[model samples]
Target chain A: MKRLTGFWAFTLLLVLLPIVFPDNYYVTVVGGTALMNAILAVGLNLLMGYAGQISLGHAAFFGIGAYASAILTTRYGWNPWPAMSAGLALTGVLAFLVARPILRLKGHYLAMATLGLGIIVHIILVQTEGLTGGPDGLSDIPGLAIFGWAVDSDLRWYIVMAVTLLLVLWLALNIIASRSGRALRALHGSEIAAEMMGIDTTATKTGVFVIAALSASLAGSLFAHQQSFISPDSFSFFFSIELVTMVVLGGMASTFGAIFGAVVLTFLPELLVVFEDYEVMIFGAILMLMMIFLPQGLFVSGQQLLRRLLARRATGTAKEGSHGAA
Target chain B: MNIRKTLSALAMGTLLGLGALHQALAAEPIKIGSFLAVTGPASFLGDPELKTLQMYVDEINGKGGVDGRQIELVHYDTGGSPKKAVNFVKRLIQKDKVDVIVGGSTSGSTLAVMPLVAKARIPFISLAGSVKIVVPPQKWTFKMPHTDAMAAAKIFGDMKKRGITKVALISGSGGFGKSGRAQSLKLAPQYGIEIVADESYGKKDTDMTAQLAKIRDSGAQAILNFGFGTGPAIVTKNVRQLGIDLPLYQSHGVASKKFIELAGDAAEGVRLPAAALLVADQLPDSDPQKPVLLAYKNKFEAKYGPVSTFGGHAYDGLFIALEAIDRANSTDKEKVRDEIEKTKGFIGTGGIYNMSPQDHLGLDLSAFKMLEIRNGDWTIVE
Candidate 1:
């Protein structure tokens, strides 16, 4: 009941936001981008926060998804829907193959392995002049349409992205509450212990990794279609790091935390536009301060403060009632 | 209750602020939208461009504005991403409601936003150097820099005149480098020159000795580098260290004082096609671009620091847009776009711009002056 209420409240907020900012371009364009980042961050939180795995090169999956859709639709003349599905499948397979070998390493080693994978993908995208159009990239990719009704306008894109993000969050929440979710939690707690308890550790890790990569793939496909262009520069290693930052800054284990972190990071630059040349410097300082003040992530610390305040209020009420009885 | 009061107060304040900003913007006569890569991987190119735009707009406004109306410049930094460029362009057209847009710092970014300008029906003057930006010649899009094809043509034309039948090619793995390489290869036979050797290095590469050695032994008469930034400078130093005696040529991408400083004494005698602004002091008194180039160079260098061709590209785009806006005498986008198309014999830092229905760039092959590094300064090869 509580989870459903939270989901509905979020949905209501999403639907109401556009009404408040009617005809606003920032809401539709920048806000739409925020929603995409939220989608990527939500799935990544599952793997990093729950499955206890790190992927420093997650942008590789994003690039693969974007490139697959772009190439299949533009070159092979496939429909956008099937092209997106094909991209998802290809990204899933790539993640499965890479995750099997790369997931064995723990901590920083795994980070470096994923980083290597990302760099290789970026290099291929740049070097392969015939297929990916080299660095200039492929443009004029058709927009996503259903029965000839195209999702073209910024408002339409925002709605589509918001709905997709909701579906993803709902799925993530359900997974976090399911039986396998417990197993994943156990795996996160202690991988060797979970294996001794008969949980399929490798399979669980790879499953979550593929899921996270698929999420990134979906976001990338949408990005390609929205911009109507795909480039090697968009899915570089820096993007992967930014994704991890979103996940951590939001509070890794919390789904809403991921979304909140994504929203902040996405809108932070725009909000800091008034800072002009001092923008980068101030952005860095704020991020540093956030890390210092709330090392457990912004959402986790904020929730803690709320709980503390509620507890204090309850205790004060109890004392007042006892004094009246006396 | 206290927190609620604070939140409501903040909301009210924001609303009032927004209302005031809206009124202020409505009162402005003309709004010019600018999107540049002011702080990212391409900031080295964008920082100076932003400075030039800021200084120029302020100067125009100070001189009683453009045609008795204040010029309101709305600039946004793209951070060198096509995705961001797309978003900014949309905001510029839809939200800011600017009459004209002058922006796009890189080939990829410019190409990314090219389709949008036509859709919005706004006059767009691109600062990017890709030939494709203006090759098909979208109705509304114009470019500032000399195209990659023109650079290739100029280098090949010079090489052909010098009887250099065979040349070695080295390029970086970037959009600019790849486009230049393609143009060179495509125009080689047409210019009666043969590509005897071809090599490439990554954009972040620090040395090109191995590539230089291969080009040295390729039996080529001269060498050409289709790259920019540190990569070309590294190749230049490597060519000198390897004792390759053939004449060296580079693309306009390396036509900056920074390239000379990076390449050290090895940059001496290396020729490339560049805007006349590079050799502005050396330009003849009667040269059409001399005065405009001198004014821009003096103002830019005096305020900021050393002036580069990248900034010169921004200056050309701004002036062109301003000229069209003034001539149109209205903020109507279509009218301004038509006025820009009709521009003829307009002196700019790049060259004399002459716009046509089929040609948006409005500059000829003569726009590029082949310059060589003489005493660590740009000198006309002629």
Candidate 2:
């Protein structure tokens, strides 16, 4: 009930934002990008925060998703829907194949393995000029359209992205509250304890890993269609690091936390444009201050503050009522 | 009756004056949007370009503005990321409602935003190096720099004259290098030159002795580098260190004083094709590009240190856009785009542009002056 309430509130904000500020740059243009980042971060949080795994190369899956859709649609003349499906299947299978071996590695080894995977994918995108169009990238990619409506304008794209983000969030929330969610929590606590509790640790890790990669793939496909262009530059090692930052900064194990972090990171640099030459420096300092002040995470600490205020008000009213009765 | 008549006349005159003032206020400044990779791996290309645009936009405004309307520059630092470029471009088109756009600092960023700019129907003058931006010309897009293909042709033309039949290729793995290599390969056979060996180094790689050694063994008479920044400088130094005396040719990517400064003494006798901006002082007064080149060079160096052709590209793009806006006599998007397409004999820092419906770039091989580094300064080579 508590989680659902917060989730609905987040959805409400997404819904009401465009109405309140029609065609707002931050809410619509940058907001669509924020939603994409939030999707990737949410699934990643499920893996890293709950299953206690790290993927330093998450952007590779993202690139795979983006490139797969891009090449299939642009070269093979496939419909966007089918092309997106192929990307999902390809990423899912690849994730499953790599998961067994990669999941066997513990701690930093796992991180290294994922990082290697990411670099290899990026190199392939650049080196495979014939298919990927080299460093120049493929342009004039067809945008997504329904039978009647086209997802062409920023507002249309924003609505589509917001709905997709909501679906991902809902699915994530359900997963967190289910039996597997408990198993994930158990995994986070201790692998040995999780295994002792009759959880299939190998299968669990693989499932979560595959799920995380699929979300990135989904977002990647949408990103390609929205931009109508795909480039290897968009999916680099730094992007992977940025995803991890969103998850950690938002609060691990908190879905809404991931969204909060994604939005902040997306909006910060755009809003900091006023700083001109000092923009990057100030952005880093502000993020540093946030982490310092809100050690628990942005959403986690905010919730805590809200609860504290509510409890104080309740007690204060009760004390006044007692005085009146006496 | 005389007092009433005087009061009515005065009231009518005041209303007419207020209406004239309102009309004057309605003539808004021309907003020019720019996005550059001013603080990233491509900063060397974008920093000077941004400085050039800023210095000139302010100057143009101070000169009573273009067509009596002030030029408002809305610039963003993309950090060489295409994702940021796309968003900032959207902000430029939809939010800022810019009349025209004048910057894209890298091939990737330009290509990423090209389709969007086309859809927006705003005039976008690209400062990037890719020929794809203008080739088979999109209706509203124009470019400033000599395309990599043009550079290859100019170099190969010189190669053909020297009767150099075989050459080795060493390019950077970045966008510029890759595109240049492709163009060279595509045009090599036509120029009657055979590529004896081909090698590439990573963008961040500082050592190229190994690549040069392989080129030395290849029976090639000369070697050409199609990369920019420190990579080209490093290659030049490595070629000298290896004692391979074959003539070294570089692309216009290194048409800057910084390249010579970086390569130091090893840069001596190295030749490349560049804009007249590099050899501005050496050009004859009769040269069509002499005045524009010298003016841009003098003003840019006076304010922002040394000038590079990359900044010259921006200078050309801005003035060209302003020229179109002036010719059209309005900031109407379609009219300005048409006027820009019809640009002829426009003196710019890059070259004398002759834009047509067929050729959006408006530069020929004559615009590219082959230059050699002599005494750590650029000198025109015959």
Candidate 3:
């Protein structure tokens, strides 16, 4: 009951803050983009946070989603909604096919293999100029429409993205409280132990991998629709780094942390205009400071402090009771 | 304890609020935005353009600025990514509210911003070379360098004049390179020339010996290398290493001194169409562009240390934009664009710019001077 109330409260806060937002530009530019990134981060968190698998090439999946939706709607004259669905399905299948061979590798080796895959995809997009429009990228993608209502404004896009984020977060939270989620968490703690307990480690990892890929794809599709453009350069190695940074900064094992990290980092660059030259340097410094000072993350640290205060108060009352009995 | 925490929070909030207010109230300078590949693989092109832009902006500000408003240039490193270009342009138009935009190093980056500029109705001048930029006319976009079509015509016309009939072509699969190859192929027959051999490589490819060998063995009279950024240099080096001694015909993009330095001895005797500023010393006093060329060349060398064809494009683009603004007597975008379209015989660093509504490209064949690299220096070939 407590958890449900907390979830509802958080969802309400997310919906209400934009209403009180200072300006439309901020909501659309900073808030909308951050929300979109939050969706991606949350999806990635399910794999990295809950399942304890690392992926450095998730942006390739993101690109695939963007390109798929872009090509479908622009070239074939399909509706935007169907294009997004097709994009997600395509990414899911591709992830499933690659996950078997990829799941065989572990640690940094797995990371490099995924990186190679991303590079190949990038190269192909650049080389096939006739099909992909080469490096100029596919432009003028159509916006999303539902029940004859078109979302043209940034505020409307934000509402749509925020609703999608809530759905994804609810599903993720449910998974975290489920039996399979426990099995995945067990594998993260000890792979051998998880296998010994008949948890089927490989299957769980692959399943989670595909889910993460789908999440990335959905986010990418949303981005394409919102920006009305897609390009291969958008999903380069730098984007991969950024996604991972958001995941790590928000505490790897915390669902809420992912959203928090995405929001903060997304707005960090905009707020740090005076440090334009030192943007990357300041980013590095903040990461280091967080790792040393907060360690678990801002959310985790706050929770820990609250727990400590509550425990101290309870112990003080017990000690007073013992003194009164004496 | 709760009061103390609230006070601290309030103090922090007040400080942040004050900072925001200060930034908001800061003098509204004439904001000029730039989209450049400042941190990616294409930084070599963008870094120099950025430096030259800064030098020009500083020079103007030092001279009391235009109409007493100091220029504030807000640059975003697109990292050679078109998506980032889109995002940065959105921020520039919707957030920063810049007056004008300048300096895109790549055709992709420039084209990405065209829609936004058209929507916002602001002047955007690109330093990229694609003819597609101004085509299908976005009401606000303009390019400084000669387009691929014009350059193609110039190269083939020069080839015909030089009595070169059979030429081999080699390019990469990039947009610039592909466009160069396509335009050259389309214009080849018009010049009474046949493409004896055609080959291509990827952008990240280092070894072009296989492709060059194939071209060499095809018995072509000359090699028409149509690519930019180190690819031309690589082709030149490989041609020499493979011992293909035919005269080389390059695109205008290879007019950079960096290409010569990269290609070493192989770059010598390679002829290409170049702007007058590149070979100013070769122009006689009787030449129509002699004065403008000499003045720009001296100023560029003194200000930016050395001059390249790319920097010359910046100088020309900026001068043309400023001239159009002056003619219009207001910073209104449509007025400036109209004035730019009606430009006639405006003495520019790149010959005389004569723009019309039908032809956004201001310069004609006469804008390019046929020059060859002899002993690491440009010399007039015709």
- Top candidate when judged by DockQ against the true structure: 1
Query: DockQ, per-model, please?
Result: 0.71, 0.64, 0.49
lDDT of 3 by residue, B269-299 (tens): 8888888888788788899888877876787
Selected candidate, larger TM-score, 1 vs 2: 1
Model 3, A168-243: lDDT tens digits are: 8888877877888899899899899999999999899998889889988998888888877566778877888888
Docking class of 1: medium
Model 3 docking category: medium
Per-residue error for A324 in candidate 2, Å, reads: 32
Q: How close to the true structure is residue B156 of candidate 1, measured as C-alpha lDDT?
A: 90
Predicted candidate 1 versus true structure: per-residue lDDT over B271-374, tens digit per residue: 99988887889889988788899999999989988888889888888988888888988878899999999999988888899999999998888999988888
- Candidate 1 colliding pairs: none
A136-160 in candidate 2: lDDT tens per residue? 8988788998786899988899998
Q: lDDT, candidate 2, residue B198?
A: 96
Instruction: Give the Cα-based TM-score of candidate 1 against the true structure.
Output: 0.95
The candidates' interface RMSDs, in order, read: 1.3, 1.0, 2.3
Comparing chain B with the reference, what is the TM-score for each candidate? 0.92, 0.90, 0.85
Task: Give residue A257's lDDT in candidate 2 (0 to 100).
Answer: 90
Highest-scoring model, lDDT: 2
Residue-level lDDT tens digits of model 2 in B1-382: 9999999989999999997798577768899999999998889889999999999989988888987788889999999999999999999999889999998898889889988988999999998888888878988788988889999999999999989999999999988899999999999999999999999999789799988999999999999999977999999999999999999999988877788889999999999998888788889999888878888889988998878888888998998899899999999999999999999998888788999999999998988999888888888887
Q: Which number leads on TM-score?
A: 1
**Candidate 3 regions with alpha-carbon error over 4 angstroms:** A4-6, A22-24, A302-326, B1-29, B68-70, B288-290
